[model samples]
Target: MEVPKKEDVINEMREILGNNDYIVQVVNTDNEVVNLLDQESGELQLEATANIFIGGSILDRGITIKNILCFFYGRNPKNFQQDTVLQHARMYGARKKEDMAVTRFHTSSAIYHILSRMNELDNQLREWFLQGNDQSDLNAVFVGYDKNIKPCAMQKIKVSDALTLKKQQRVLPVGMWTGSKTATKKMMAEIDHLVNESMCGQKLDADGFFYMNKDVAQQIIALIEDTYVYDEKYGNIDHKSDMRELLCALEYCTERSGGKLRAMVRTDRNMTRIRANGGFIDSPEDGRTDLKPARERALHEPVLMLLRQNGQKEETEYGNIGWNNAPFYWPVLLTQEDLAPVMFALDQRRKGKQLTIDLTEMLEGVNPDEVLKLSYAGNPIDQFGKEGTTYANAEEAAVETRWLKESVASLFIEKDEQGNWKHNPAVPFDEKNDHGVYSLNHGHFPFVLRDYKYILLRNGRNANAPLMLLELFPKDEWIIDPRGDFDEENNLLDDNGQDILLYGSDVIYDKNMNKTNFEDKSITLWYIEYPVKRVVKYKCLKK
Candidate 1:
């Protein structure tokens, strides 16, 4: 009843393989996924397949191929996402270990940099993660190591990737993170020293960041570049950023801004795992190499904590074991105004010049109208009844509407990083989290890594409270039945993660229904979260 069309894909596949024997098929929903086997060859078929299979978005993750000898990934890798790349790394386990030698990675130089960066981060995460597993070490359990950028929870437990980890170099921090008041003051003075020397001729235009000249840029890099000098206890973490990356950034600045580049020496530590959903609990204080910052301020800016040694009671540095000397002693780069005046006059009562400045009060200015609230939008959920145009029940509409108007109050955070807050991240990663890990009772937003324009919060005295996003429409806006990251076995979970709805296998569709995901039979809480700006006026046909 169907005739084959002359498809460009088939021709392209034939040309690529240099053979006329390859097969290519375009699969539609009408053709069930279960029967995607060839009639003659009996090989597994997909949306499209040959000796080489090809697909996009749908093929980005989930499917596990055995003996996938070669990978030809030539996609653009600008702002690279590491989890996506890991998913595409089809070769794994002892089964495909031999396949590594012959397996080729044909990618651009940028992708190479991305991979190098990721691999470097992975090694550090593995080392610290293994150390953190010790429950008795309260310092390790509740310290600053929380901020290290990690791979998905599943990947964190594995160290068998011979290709990425074999003979791996340690990735050291860029500079010292200081916790001492004297150190903070001395550092601020040093910046003042640099400023007096460098800003003599450099004009402060409204266009660039602090220390806006190229020479100053060079100076900052030079100061921090070699600070990773010899350390006995922790050995060394190879330098993270270098002249090459800075030079590239400089070049970009010069070419784009004509003659100026507003540069900033970013003292940041907000690296994240994009695809890993360790569930809606708030992530613990991201550990840093310096002492932890005040709690309230931690929410806005990434804070580096001074950590204890991985295995010992002392801090993770090199000093005479009990003399209280920091193993590492680097200075924090900060604005002179934010730092207390350098303590030139020291007295017995003065502790290292006493730079007792509250960074939180300085950083988090109280914005009177700042809306920490999440917004919700869509077809009136559950309220639409048999009338189709009116409310299913007055009580349902009234309850939902009253709930919508109510606002969520600000949260209470504590010293041990616990509070009346809902984003509790005590949930372990690297495993199944369907019922246990994800709880509606917790008032936290689901953990996801996508760049959402906004967030929403579902309201009401419901069993499960969900976070929401605003202005999301049906077409591409609502990410219904979205996919989750791989589990420990590398198997994809259908019911968990962002926008994923699990229908218990059977899905009978009604063609007349709007394209949002209610057609699927998922038992999970309706944490409705899709969004855009509140100012952008839009409409949904489902309404």
Candidate 2:
């Protein structure tokens, strides 16, 4: 920030350009709008003299740099939301890979992790895109882990869709299928023989589990790749490559590293697919949210049955079900930066403010800290998002974020058959009219939130940040006019915390929240932890 250091930076940039004549300049809000432009031509004026420019977070997004060869970004936020971090990737469209040295991204290790995760997310979304899926289409997609570190809320997959979720539970693969068909035939003929030799007559699991030494597992994976077919419409070669790579790496981590790879094979097809509110595939995330391709499926078949949990009824058969009673995990997970917002909320709640979480609906046999599934089976160490509801520390999210500030402003409202402003009865309202008023009684679904983000992200209307924005809402008396109707002036009725935010929207979205209890009536916000982070982290890296 010092002038002399800035001069040195400019001078170094000039040396890089081999042009002493290049102009160096400092631009900021102090400069008028016209100062950023060439008044004569009305074009964006380039600070050509000084090729190096220094500023803060304000310039992080929106501007395009066509010839930027080097980007040095040092400012890192206390919390790193993926979307915000990706915005600083100003070097996106740079095409000269050979000249990548000229076009480089310089940031800290923490920032690099965020950028890497963003890229992983983009790639996963790309795979879904190739399936002819778009943001507007409702699909049982895995976007990312919610703060509970679970697969974010998904459009509950229809049982009729025949899309069953197959999760490997509480175990690692002993040996990936990599042997030649002849070898596979040989191996299958005497799986016991192969394991007996490796384990001295001991099976990893009584349920037909067997062990294969690292060398044998490696051979099997190589063979699987050599033999796996990629001809099916839903089977992508990339997915196959990913599976083989995963098995190979797992072998390296467990078997090759002199540890046994524990695995189990189940014949039970009665397993229920437990979709967390904002849940995804279970632990050891491996980054692949899509179902295993046919090529890989041939080796590890899905055995979980698709069903709404017992004691829970569908509004319509196979229709979307409320997530409150679905499942839950404990001790909510949050980004490190989210601590402040969570603490802020706790402090406010201490004043007897209604920061309540809905706990009305109970999935039988479910409780906090213990992961619950429909079967009431003990929580698997490897699974996540099987829990009921999870909360996010939205306080860490910046209040100035466009999506956070404008979410209610942009809700898409659909009309019922009667043509009334068919409001979602779930949101609170005044007795006089369906006057929208902010209240703690409201509970939200993760899918709807992600849907908005998905649409906005596609059209460049969103920042692709975490959906943890609601916590930024002021805990005490920050009334937001949900009806979104304001005077022509778009007036602010008050300057205090009770200010009425007058807003109107082109589309009215169906907004609803989790119901705490029918008898309790009032809503209070509460956060409980969930162990779902691994399921997200595992599937990110590519071979």
Candidate 3:
């Protein structure tokens, strides 16, 4: 048989690819092998003495050729031939094909081992990576792969970068409930004690512990009822009358002394007991234990006597039991300036003016529009109702209409003068009240706005303005009239958008006092829309 020409071999290879529908096209027809229209299946198949290149025609197509075995079909030339011909002969062909197969096998095996080792190493390194690069040497030493397939120094550098990238993408810790050891121990002890007390007389083995502790049950019940009475009287106060008297006297003394007498007294007999029983003793060697009784006499006794006199007088005249006699006792008090802003805000509220502070603006520095979006639940109608909708342009009207349909109704209506229909005077109507003025069951806009402002201030924003409003609404006047206003069908009336008007109040002044510069001010105003009803407001008259 005549030797095939180089052109013939090329044409034959092209024909084979074309016949099998695997050929895309061919390129670089000079001396070097270059692929242009290459298609790959599971395996590669080539009938050539020359080197060939192969890949997918479309970059994304899967390789589908199978069994990819190659065999040289030409014989070696006996004499030196042209370099190109020698390179393409059977001897070079077989050697090149062998090398390709060996290289592929080794590369595959190496990759598999690397991946397996990588998983193991990753598991070991996971914690280290999470802790960050604070311990770099430990991370470097612990990272390992098979010695034969060990990554190069460059690969190590890349791996370190990869680790850092992974760490950066990790989630951070949210809120922390951290505390000192003493605090934690105290909390745990309290919880355990509560649980024990709760389960104290319960049955253990069948009618066992409960039946056995009958007297104990009676004692526990009595204790609970008695303690409940004390709790009611003092709230969180430790020594009912004693603490109250001491506190009151201390206040008087402090004011008289221009706050020079800043000392606090413990009037609770329990506190005296603790001090005597070494409960208040921080160390046995402190040497001040003998002075406990003296301190109590000098601090607590006088205060208690003064408070008793005041309480007796109050009881005689007004039949009012002082708050000091309440069950629980919490010794926290607010001074006039401490409550100033709230008083001012309350005054503003009484005069029928919008008193509000945007918390989002103060804390987050977010855009007003974004803040509005966060506060608003849905489209204009959805949040505000059809008539309540505020539109910036006509295009928004259709969208707003669609949004209103999906939204909850917030419209409230009230009869105005001349028997004409009018929107509820309150802005941000509550669904449960006919009148926009806040009652227990409805009128929540002021509360929500106030809370939002508080949160902003709590989060380190300027909350001074909102605090003023808080003073306007004293604790005593916090009454919610659940049954105040309802529709004819007895359904709760929605506040509509008029609930916003609830915040419109001028200045509320103290009923008895005419001093314009009082430390704390209490004022009442008529609801702007419902002028017949008086709303009490508190303010700090300082600033």
Best by TM-score: 2
Task: List candidate 1 stretches off by more than 4 Å.
Answer: 1-19, 24-50, 75-79, 92-94, 131-543
Q: How many clashes does each candidate structure show, in the order listed?
A: 25, 50, 66
Instruction: Please provide, for model 1 over 27-142, each residue's C-alpha lDDT reduced to its tens digit, 9 standing for 90 to 100.
Output: 33324323665455544453333356555554455545545655655554213445666666553333444566445566555445566666665565465467654232111211
User: Comparing candidate 2 with candidate 3, which one achieves the higher TM-score?
Assistant: 2
For candidate 2, lDDT tens digit of each residue in 288-403? 32122211321322111111112122342322222222211110000111111100000011122332322223212333223221111112212322222222433322122221
**All candidates' lDDT scores?**
0.32, 0.31, 0.26
Please give the lDDT score for candidate 3: 0.26
Local error of candidate 2 at residue 94 (angstroms): 4.8
User: Could you tell me which 10 consecutive residues in candidate 3 have the lowest summed lDDT?
Assistant: 340-349
Ten contiguous residues minimizing lDDT sum, candidate 1: 162-171
- Candidate 1 residue-wise lDDT at 9: 46
Query: RMSD, model 2, all Cα superposed?
Result: 21.8
- Model 3: how far is 297 from its true place, Å? 53
The C-alpha RMSD in Å for every predicted model, in order, reads 22.6, 21.8, 30.7
| Model 3 / residue 244 / CA error / Å | 46
**Which has the higher TM-score value, candidate number 1 or candidate number 3?**
1
TM-score-best of 1 and 2: 2
